[model samples]
Target: MGFDQYHEPPNELPDEVRTFARMILSLIEEAQAIDWYEQRMAVEKDKEAKAIMRNAQKEEFKHFGMDLEFLLRRKPQWREILQGILFQDGDIVEHGEEAEEAVD
Candidate 1:
């Protein structure tokens, strides 16, 4: 191996960037959950099942891109809160409860 091909270290992300990343990751998880729900609901043979899934999918897509836009816009605090909710280390229920409390 030659020293001519040294690998560069990844850049250190600011707190805002980290938060945005986490938020996007969470949105992805939510989308996956919606997909799972849609699949489960499909087994019921209900006519509205497909419509529900389609709407959920559309909302997921919107949120996914919205999170990206927030990151791009450097809305750090909002991103931080969103990330806190998304990557709650398996404490989604608690995070949601806290979010609700915070809103009040």
Candidate 2:
């Protein structure tokens, strides 16, 4: 499709960099799909339509998670930071600050 993901010349980018850019774009698209489905479900009148939208949104959520996991695997520092921040009980901002400090 479009090569809008590349800020620099795509021809100059290594294959890995190009692949990373593609994954980033996929992550963004998945997030946008989730948001669109949320808005659509909110105003939808038909029960069946809302149910379908909800299902589609769940699929988008899974895709988003997969994309995030893939990117995180490529960035160990990011993974380390998120480990301290995700799924733990505490002040979120505090957790984020602690995670950032830990990484640093």
Candidate 3:
């Protein structure tokens, strides 16, 4: 079987790199799940169904966060750049620009 998450052959990739790729795939899946729930909930007629979707979406959020944190721990540059952009008020693009420039 082939895995799209890996650019190189999985067997040739080191254990850590393979694990990172798996987590990246997991994060993407979780984000997709969250988006799917949002779309379903928006048009859902039943209040009970909407509530269930929202609860499921929250679990996806946690999974995404855990995946992101794991990746960031292994990539210092990523952690550095996001620190300037995430959870901060004001212009996001400007913060991203500043973060990128700071890394240089």
Candidate 4:
């Protein structure tokens, strides 16, 4: 299997860390799939083809959400940081800074 996700030696990492890395890669791949479908939908002239692409994109969104939730459950600090940034109406950068500060 591909171990391209790891910068460090996979053998040296704990099982949980390895799983985290795999999930992170899966999340990235899902996001890429979503983007690809979106681009294809934009250029696609056929209405039925665009509808299929949209359906596929929706699946990717579900996959991305599940992956994110799994990662958040694994890392409480990450959850805390995202809680400060996500679903908020204010400045995102400001929220990020605040989240970091809140963690400290």
Could you say which candidate leads in lDDT?
A: 2
Clashes of 1: 0
Off by over 4 Å in 3: none
User: What TM-score should be assigned to candidate 1?
Assistant: 0.39
What TM-score fits each model? Answer: 0.39, 0.95, 0.95, 0.94
Q: Candidate 4: RMSD over Cα atoms? A: 1.2
Overall lDDT per candidate, in order of appearance: 0.64, 0.96, 0.94, 0.95
lDDT of 3 by residue, 10-102 (tens): 889999999999999999999999999999998999999899899999999999999999999999999999999999999999999999899
Write down the lDDT that model 1 would get. 0.64
Clashing pairs in 2: none
For residues 1-104, could you state the per-residue lDDT of candidate 2 as single tens digits? 34888999998899999999999999999999999999999999999999999999999999999999999999999999999999999799999999999999
Query: Cα lDDT for residue 10, model 3?
Result: 85
Clashing residue pair totals per candidate (backbone < 3 A) = 0, 0, 0, 0
- Residue 75, model 4: Cα distance from true site in angstroms: 0.5
Q: What would the per-residue lDDT of candidate 1 be over residues 26-59, giving only the tens digit for each residue?
A: 6667678767766766675766876787677678
Q: Is candidate 3 or candidate 4 better by TM-score?
A: 3
**Between the candidate structures 2 and 4, which one is better when assessed by lDDT?**
2
User: Model 3 — which ten-residue stretch has the worst lDDT?
Assistant: 1-10
Question: Positional deviation of 50 in candidate 1, in angstroms?
Answer: 2.8
